[model samples]
Target: AQSVTQPDIHITVSEGASLELRCNYSYGATPYLFWYVQSPGQGLQLLLKYFSGDTLVQGIKGFEAEFKRSQSSFNLRKPSVHWSDAAEYFCAVEPSNTGKLIFGQGTTLQVKP
Candidate 1:
């Protein structure tokens, strides 16, 4: 079975400051990893994904993540955040065959200007 855990339930960042959100997974094999963001009262939008190749992947809205096999982690990072970046972030994983995904509880980002 594949699963994900996000230790932090919420995080706060000042505008123009760096940000990082943690993610950890448990799976038998390499899984398809993804990070998604949802604005208030909105659906989720894919930020980035890690299927193969490079460990570090970049996404829209100046977001990036690195997949680390040893730590079973895929943490999201941003050089500088904006107030509009405040939203709920979810980390998900899809096991080999199944299209269904397992998502972490979520991490709410609070951006202060």
Candidate 2:
């Protein structure tokens, strides 16, 4: 079974500041990892995914993440925050057999200018 946990329920960041969101997962084998962002009343958009090779992966909107196998962590990071980045971020994991994803509760990002 695969599962994900996001420790932060919500976060606030000043515009143009750095941002980091935590994610942890439990799985038997290497899992397909993903980060998604959802704006208010909108669907989730894929930020990035880690399937094979490379511990670090970059995604849209200048977002990136590093996969740590030992810690079972995949944390999202951004160099600069934007007001448009204010949204809900979710961490997901796909199990080895099934294509379905198990998602975390999600962290709502509040941007302050």
Q: After superposition, how far is residue 32 of candidate 1 from its true place, in Å?
A: 0.2
| Backbone clash total, candidate 1 | 0
Q: Give each prediction's root-mean-square deviation over alpha carbons.
A: 0.7, 0.8
Q: RMSD to the native, candidate 2?
A: 0.8
lDDT of 2 by residue, 16-97 (tens): 9999999999997889999999999999999999998999999999999999999999999999999999999999999974
Displacement of the residue 49 alpha carbon in candidate 2, Å: 0.4
Instruction: Write model 1 residue lDDT over 85-111, tens digit each, in one string.
Output: 999999999998588899999999999
lDDT value for candidate 1?
Answer: 0.96
User: Runs in model 1 with CA error above 4 Å?
Assistant: none
> TM-score of each candidate?
0.97, 0.97
- Clash count per candidate: 0, 0
lDDT of each: 0.96, 0.96
